[model samples]
Target: MIETIVFDVGETITRDDRYWASWADWLDIPRHTLSALVGAVVAQGRDNADALRLARPGIDVAAEYHAREAAGRGEHLDESDLYDDVRPALSSLRDLGTRVIIAGNQTSRAGELLRGLDLPADLVVTSGEWGVAKPQPEFFQRVLEVAQAAPRRTLYVGDHPVNDTFPAKAAGLRTAHIRRGPWGHLWADDPKVMEASDWRIDSLTQLTTLIEG
Candidate 1:
């Protein structure tokens, strides 16, 4: 039985594409360019530090993520509109006997973004707090410890195959890929994710059936 359901923050639940698109200038790249960099980082098996070198520092990536949400009369709105089915869906999962949590790459600004949205999160695993990014086994270990969960008993869901799915699987968690969008343009392909994810879906609505089946 799956006792815990963990999520990758940006795309998995937060609709990250819109958020990041607003702040693309800081990274000095186009949407496609940033996507290429992420892909290359994953393909080369670079750690978070290495990824940072490619992206550069001092740009406040977190604030940029929030800026998009707060921009232009807030058509999309703040984190409040992150995922249309977020709170209700996660709450439903909790009602069905699963604990829900968020594992994200967030700094203070990122935290502020989430707060502005009024997200009801049980636990958060952040890169700023941990000093590491996901897809690293150590990051998963920390998550398991914080949740007081055994990897085997957990279900991890993420958008990226390279970072979220592969590492989560390696850490012994059952993995799922929420492949709603074309992530291929954004992240490099990794065999580890290519080989080991237990399930893949274009929507979280498909997840419950997979977990129960």
Candidate 2:
């Protein structure tokens, strides 16, 4: 039986539309333009971190990210910031005596943001705090270690094919691909990636039934 449920934060539990749209406004660029650049970068198999550098000439991307992180501190994610199905699924999962965790590739301030939202997770882990990012086996190893979970009994839910589902499954954990995020939607019809996931859902609410069923 699955004892632990590990989740990807961005586009999985929380929607990043407002965050990225705010970034576009800060950069004085059209939101759609920024979105397209990010999508293009990902389409070419590049990291979203590379988008700013590729789109803007002579800008210090690392510093800019740090600045954004600093500015984003103490900011709370409102109910509208999360998907409609998130809270219900999380609550149901927790009530089932399952250990639910939110782990993702986010900045050091991720824990604070998660706390601000009052998510129904037992733990929150981020790449910045762990000093390693996802798709790297070490990160997933840390996740398992922190959760005190055996790989076989753990379930990882995320939208990333290469980053989230692929690696987690390879690590001996089951994976659920949520077809809502950029990576998920972009590779939705790709049999190679989609076939790797143990399960797939269009909405978070479906997770409850998936777990119960």
Candidate 3:
């Protein structure tokens, strides 16, 4: 039985529309342009942030993020940004006595905002808060530590094949590939992703059935 279900933040629990749109506005580029660039980078197995670099050559994304904050434009999250299924699915899992955790490659500020939403989760954390990011063995190690469960009993659900399914499987956690986000759809049929995932789900609601079954 799966005692713990850990989730990826972006494109898993929340929609990333605002995130990319915000960046497009910040860089004064068309939203479609940035979106295409992001998709291109993902297809090439490059960091999605490379889209920003492609938009404005030599632009330091880290420094620009600070500048945006200084100018009163920063990461923003609210209930509307969440996926429609997020609340019902997560709440249902918790109601079933499963441990629910939200962990992903997000900023510490994102972590704070997520916690503020008061979702029915046992813990919500981010790579920025933990000083490590996904695809790193250390990140999954920290996940295992926080979950306090045997790897085989903990399930990691995410959309990104490279960062989510592959690494979590390597860490011994059962992996579920959710077919939601762009990366999710783009690689859903890829051989490696199929090989790594123990389950393929279309929505968070499917998790409830998986756990109960």
Best by lDDT: 3
* lDDT over C-alpha atoms for residue 37 of model 1: 62
How would you order the candidates by lDDT, starting with the best?
Answer: 3, 2, 1
Question: For each predicted model, how many residue pairs clash, with residues at least 3 apart or on different chains?
Answer: 2, 0, 0
Which pairs of residues collide in model 3? Answer: none
Worst 10 residues of 2 by lDDT: 68-77
Candidate 2 lDDT tens digits, 124-192: 878988899999999899889876779987999998888898899888888899898788898777787
lDDT of 3 by residue, 1-213 (tens): 999999999999999999999999999999999999999998898889999999999999999999998998999999999999999999999999999999999999999999999998999999999999999999999999988789999999999988999999999999999998789999999999999999999999999999989
User: After superposing candidate 2, which stretches have Cα over 4 Å from the reference?
Assistant: 69-76
TM-score of 1: 0.70
Worst 10 residues of 3 by lDDT: 42-51
Question: Which runs of model 1 end up more than 4 angstroms from their true locations?
Answer: 25-77, 184-194
Number of the candidate with higher lDDT, 2 or 3: 3
Clashing pairs in 2: none
- What's the lDDT for all of these models? 0.66, 0.83, 0.95
